[model samples]
Target chain A: MERNLHYLKGSFLKDRLFANNFIITLLFVLLALAPLFLSDFRTNLLGKFIAYAILALGIDLIWGYTGILSLGHGVYFGLGAYCMAMYLKLEASNGKLPDFMSWSGQKVLPWFWKPFVYAPVAIILSVLVPAILALIIGYLTFKNRIKGVYFSILTQALSIIFVVLFVGQQAYTGGTNGITNFKTIFGFPLSSSSTKVTLYYVALGFLILAFLFCRWIVQSRFGKVLIAIRDSENRARFSGYNPAIYKTFVYCISAGLAGLAGALFVPQVGIISPAEMGIVPSVEMVIWVAIGGRGTLVGAVIGAILVNSLKSMVSEGFPAAWSYFIGISFVAVVIFMPYGLAGLLNQIKRKIYTQKSVKQYSSAALNILEESGCDEYVG
Target chain B: MLDAICGRVKPAEGKIIFKGIKDVTEMSEHQIVELGIGRKFQVPSVFMGITIYENMELAAARKRSLYSTLFTKLSKEQMERIQDVLQKIGLYEKRYRTPAALSHGEKQWLEIGMLLVQQPEIMLLDEPVAGMGRKETDKTGRLLKEISEKCSVIVVEHDMEFVREYADKVTVLHEGRLLDEGNMHEIQENPKVMEVYLGRGGEGCD
Candidate 1:
């Protein structure tokens, strides 16, 4: 009557994994075929959401599990996007340097700009730049024992600093407007319908791959060590696990994934800017994870999708007070649904099954009542 | 080993050797932990985000191939060892539950269990009964006595009752300095220990 799970001896855990993977696989298939039926707009929108979901998962890995809320992850995301955006910009320029440079009265390309023309170099730099930044920040903060709300604030400050630097250096970074107007990726036409579709599916493939990578990490001894740091960092040290190393690993992983997401996102959306990598955007990224469900991978994915979709809808409908709507949504969910949407859905599922099981249990009691002559007690 | 370290010069300033090795200051904490000089914390530190099984697995330090740990699943044998350790700590029922939900005493109990799985030669415990009730304390005391048979136990506890029941040799520390070291009876009767642990009037622990 109570679901008969205990007798199965871990069958339920195995089944849950299988079921989750199966659902993810189905989602992948659905997404892959979506471009065939849906218009370019829907596929592009879906591609954008998938990219955002990747970002959310990345943030949640550090903020949710390790308890290190990084508001600078958006900076990492932007770095990756800027890398891709630069390559796209260079390709569009046809081996010539960007127009803005010539307009600024430059004769030759910048030395730092030469390597990014290579696609592989751009991708590698996208990952390396963010990893290096996170490494430096993580090393400094953790070494100083700067944790709790202070660490969060530090990361947020880093985000602000990155955005300001990029904006102030407009001569090279395209200023506040950032880079856009891309026409090709690895020599493929960007505006072509099929390329767009292929990019969307490619994004889907990468998201699934990222999910597998994250799953491997969260299921590993490294993950366990992260949990240890979350609970009691000092205790983790006493147990022979240097909390600094584990934190650094997770932080770098989170940043690298954000970079990966950003790389994919730049092509699909055809834009990358200083605005997208600042403190506000980073905070927004965290909200996606929070509104979905922190610490649960599916929840992070679902939350990113749901929140971004709501943003799209609300911005279209209200356009003026969408931020207000999102703010209210955040407060309501945090107050009433601590576990967020996934937790609420799980509760609803539990309730429905509980209602059915209760009815069956009552019927069983009724049979006992009839057989044992306990009708008086029932009445 | 006892004479060199008991009340002698500081460890960093002077050489104190163990086993067959002498003047061993180059060993890392991980190496020290691996080489039988085990230490436990004041708080259990039971990795709140993951399950009890994972905490045990880390303490067991028995992973086969670091790469395999990342790619492959934890084996049945690993799970069984985890369960066995959880059972030892009386926390098998809460194996899947996180430490955030565990009571203070239960966390302490879990700390004890996780450390036991490490198989340390000289276990360094800190107030193992701090935040526990009489039942939990009594159980922990018995467990400490049982554990002390195989390994030397150094319990840094203020609970005199726990000390009286479990300590084979009691060392009193006041203001970051050891005041006395002897069996419980000798420590209780010593003038300095009485002044430090007991009240100024020379009354015994309540």
Candidate 2:
């Protein structure tokens, strides 16, 4: 009996040592440790990656699990960034109207811009605007059952239209230039190292929170319905889950997260532009999710970091070849990883655990039954 | 059973007053399913992406949130219930295999396993043995007979042999209307059923 207890404890310890949980917590610890040793530039780069990860996770919630591949996620991100930028722009002007409008010969700030001049309202509006847009779009599209590639095309069109409008509207939106060269965020100078570090950690905190939030959502009952829709949408409908409601909820959540990420991003990146909200940039975010593993949270983070960090290195090292690298990598990950890097890791983890548990459990259980003299009862 | 078991195919029309005042429009399809009104499609609607076990787990996982499903391990009791249902349908060996790899007969059995796990108050199976082989059809008939002992089962099938073997009661649907409802013998010999089943374009062997 004592021997059996020891074996069980040993197996329990063994399981904990290499569990998916252990790995995830370890990675988080590593991320926390990174900034301590890394320089400001690298820390800022990591912050940028975390922001991108947030976007990818939101997209994955909509596109990967819910099977609603949206092209308008960039618009959500843009909305958040624009809101944060509006506040920054307002603060930079020091209670006066912004320079661009002053240069363009405007006497007063627009009524719509007046509300956003306040930080709290801008943040609320930033998240709300995208959610409201997504809710409407999701309602119209999903109710009509406009699925497959058609949905993708419609979203892509939205992205193009948003970019065009943002670009063309120069006076109100800052047009092609966008609201940039921000001197302050909530009265704190961006030039200060402490502020930069604080913002970096803020971005990191938000990213971690987003990851945990998504992780919870994906593991919830609502998440099973999502996978059901993904696996077989028709089945989910007949089973009594309104696919539209699930789709709408997840899409809004995705939009809200993207908007939140954008809000965080603007402070760190210090700009919001039509260029960043364009068709290609939005599609590139999708690529990050695809290459990382769409269904897995960590995959989103890893893919963002790996791709962006590589891009940073390549831009400095090889410049123009970066696009070629991105293109080839996208195709390679799609064709080879099919499940993505996280999926590959999951497969390895499963095999290891399955082998270990099957062997250890059967022996332990059999011995327990034999000792207890209840083998028949166990069967 | 016959009037309560009337021709209303749309579950949205289900009206059951409990103590006379609470509206259950908020009750979802899965809630209705859990409340014992099991539904199967006209065509088999298996989760084609997963294994027979995982498909059952997906239904079982409905009881859990996405986070619990992703993080928490399935308890032994849950695994046992899944295994028992699979074994009842003789698909225990194929539990680990994907639905795409399953044969039409196995797919039917898999659906039955899914229903068995759910153990609904009423089982609504549509064309349960539509594309199944003779032996597999016999196995399905036996499975249904076993399932019928516990709940009210309504099967929508064109196979006269399957209905005759398993149905305690039969309802014939023609042009989205319930043409006739009775016991298997009554439905088999009723002039209206004969005329409808044998008379409906003679496309099927009566």
Candidate 3:
């Protein structure tokens, strides 16, 4: 009993586990009913936001927990989007070269694009390619002990290189215009409202799955190690953990999650451009994780949806001032609410619980003292 | 020298043979740690952000692989081992507190406890009682004496009193070269050791 009490004291795992479950359930319920209450266009917009939320989840896993700030996540996201886009384009073209390739005078399908003709192959490649790339990059950087600002700058450079490469290959990648004007996905009309709604649900499902997966990782002993690494890499290494290998593994996993989000995103948004894979979008992705609460999985999702929603609303009204609004909000979050939205919520909950416990303990102590005084007086 | 032996730095020209085999001149720190050689830094390097118990858990992890750490739950024996170390270090009451909450000497004890949980074949502690009060230093001396019974312990310290009380054999170094080697009594009587410690030309003892 004493051991159990010891385990329970300050174990954030026990309290947050219940709260996390409740929030997840509520979120799914809201997502499931969103289609019924919203128009087709709005629902489609929400689908796109859900995709960003998935990407933010990936950012939180790497940057928030592992302390590996990757500004090159857009590269993985773009790779997955392109992979899915290739398959969709092939299905639309009926086994011929996509329109842009033919327009550019290429008579043959690129050998790399051939494997994506099969849906299963495309999906598998979409996830694996990004993971593999991340593994190689992680091995190179981490093995050399390149970390902190250096790692972030390296990732930013990667994003720029990918953007330039994608834009340069006009015949293969569709260049700055990106792959678009798709008519169908697996014989279902992409333009159909019903298809859009169905795709929205699919994106929502994947987002929840990604969130749960991240939560599982963070709760496990592995997650504790990641936090330990973030706190002090040298101390963790001295404790026998190979910090490089752990960093590489988490980096690859983060890349894979971003890839999955991009795979879903391409179909919903109907475009996968070099612009989407550039420095700005990648930095914006980090901002979402930052504003949400770096370490909290739910905070990442909330931050993504809220920031993107705010962006759309602000842009629709003023157009030129949305960037200013985003900048101010990021600064405010950093200064005033460093822990982000979830952290604020946790703080409030803790305050209330602690106050109530304090009251109960004090009152019990007073009663004991009074009874002891009465006993002494009677004696 | 402990840093060199633990592969934190490569020696300019030397080989470190442990247990009469496997020259560890080019081994990485992780490989050296795997060879049953544990090292404690001069400064207490416990993870400050985590609870002391979690620090113990990290040190007690057997596999140390990314996947195994993710899935492996601590066995009853592992828990008992951690508890034993905590009790031995007298930090069981503060196990749930972060290392930041600990006193300097407590942090030192926690690091010693971390090493003790690993149960290494050889332990290298650097200045274990550097900032400790007299009471804590005496306790540390007792602890080291107890630890030496289980494994070979080499402590690098400048505290002559601690060395005299706890150390069975002493190797004295002067200006990065071996000056004398003997028990504390013999070292006190040696002329060269005296020159290095007390007979220096009016500079005063270090």
Candidate 4:
């Protein structure tokens, strides 16, 4: 009977894993085929949404899995976007100072901009810079045991600080207009349709990779410790897991993912701006995760695409009403569907399976008892 | 005092040397735990988001560094140890369920099971029976008595009857100062204990 119960439990877990894999595959397949049906302009827009999905996945990791809500993810994303933009800007200038630097009356490239002239350095720095910053911030705050909404507030302040820094440095950064008017990336014209489609696929590929990575993390022993920390930091501390180290590491990983998303986003969207990294966009990034399902990786992707699509469609028609609509939807999601879309789907699935499982359990129990003669039963 | 030992609270003055070696007061809570000292809080503090099996897995894990935890799986022995602890705590049947499904006493037992899997050299329990009923308290007492055979068990408890039944030695404190120290019977008979703790003819104060 005990063995039978164990077998049943094992199958139950396997079934959940199977369902998760199936859904993920289906989502990816649909995305992979999207370019076939979507127009070039529409596909480019979706590529941008896919980039947001990657950013949302990062948010879900820190907030959903680790219970560390960060409202400054936009800053990391912007940093990556800026890195890619700098590289592209340099490529556009063809060995001369970028147009912005020349307009600002700079004679030579800033020392900081020189490193970004190399494509590989720019790419690596996009991811590394945010991760390093997150490590610094995470170590400072988490080591001192600062957490919960306080962490969120701190991240918000970080976003504000980055925005001000970028806006104030008009000579290096592009001031209020930000970095735009890009010509090419590695000699491919930015206006080319082929480039747009390829960028869409690239964005899609990264989103899938990010999703898998996040899933791996939340499933590992370390991931369990993350959930453990989220639930009870003191308990994890007493269990021999350092909450500060774990939190800091996960925070860095999250920031790195956001950075990757930002890098992917810049080329397709053709702009990297201070406005993108402001507190407003940072909070909106959180909203994407919240609306999809905070902890569920797939939900982040779904939520990002769905919300962005809605915004584009609705805002195009009802520009003024879009704000009111989004505001109400966010409140509605928080109050009515706290678990978000993915959680709602899971609830419905469990509701459908509950009766079937109960019957299966009782019948299996009876079979086991008959076969093994109930003698070992402790209950 | 338990908090000081667990590195949760800083001591005003004093050194806590573990096994005549490491200075526990100088370490962090996780570092002290890594040095083979585990603590059970007054309230059951199992991870509510995960399953009971996972709670045990986290406790049983020895290589708890970021890289090891992320990349490696628990060995067969560690996995078996988790199963054994769960069975001993009588939670094997509900191992897949979250701690939220557990009753108060079961949560306490689960917490104990978690500590057991850690196999700490010394276990510090704070009010392990604070909210337990008679039967649960008796069961926990038996559990701790069994655990003490393998490692040092230090319990900070106020239940005098419980201490009398289970403890090998007793120390009575009055306003953070030691009032009496001996076996349960000697402490019971001590005039100072009677004056400060038990009160008048040993009727019991707690």
TM values, all candidates: 0.86, 0.80, 0.93, 0.96
lDDT of 4 by residue, A257-307 (tens): 999999999999999999999999998999999999988998898999999
Q: Candidate 2, DockQ to 2 decimals?
A: 0.31
Indicate the TM-score of model 4.
Answer: 0.96
List pairs with backbone clashes in candidate 2.
A218-B66, A219-B65, A219-B66, A219-B67, A220-B65, A220-B66, A220-B67, A221-B65, A221-B66, B36-B121
Output the worst ten-in-a-row residue range by lDDT, candidate 1 chain A.
A1-10
Off by over 4 Å in 1: A1-6, A349-379, B1-35, B62-84, B99-103, B195-199, B202-206
In model 4, residue pairs whose N, Cα or C atoms come closer than 3 Å (at least 3 residues apart or on different chains), thus clashing, are none
Highest lDDT model number: 4
Q: What digit string (tens of lDDT, one per residue) describes model 1 on residues A32-72?
A: 78788888988888898899888888887897778888877
Model 2 chain A: lowest-lDDT 10 consecutive positions: A9-18
Model 4 misplacement above 4 A: A365-379, B198-206
For model 1, residues B36-71, the per-residue Cα lDDT tens digits are: 666666656677777776677777654333354456
In model 3, the Cα lDDT at residue A323 comes to 92
| Most DockQ-accurate candidate | 4
Off by over 4 Å in 3: A1-13, A360-379, B201-206
DockQ of 4: 0.88
Q: Per DockQ, what order, best first? A: 4, 3, 1, 2
Candidate 4 second chain TM: 0.94
Model 1 misses residue A252 by how many Å?
1.5
Docking class of predicted structure 1: acceptable
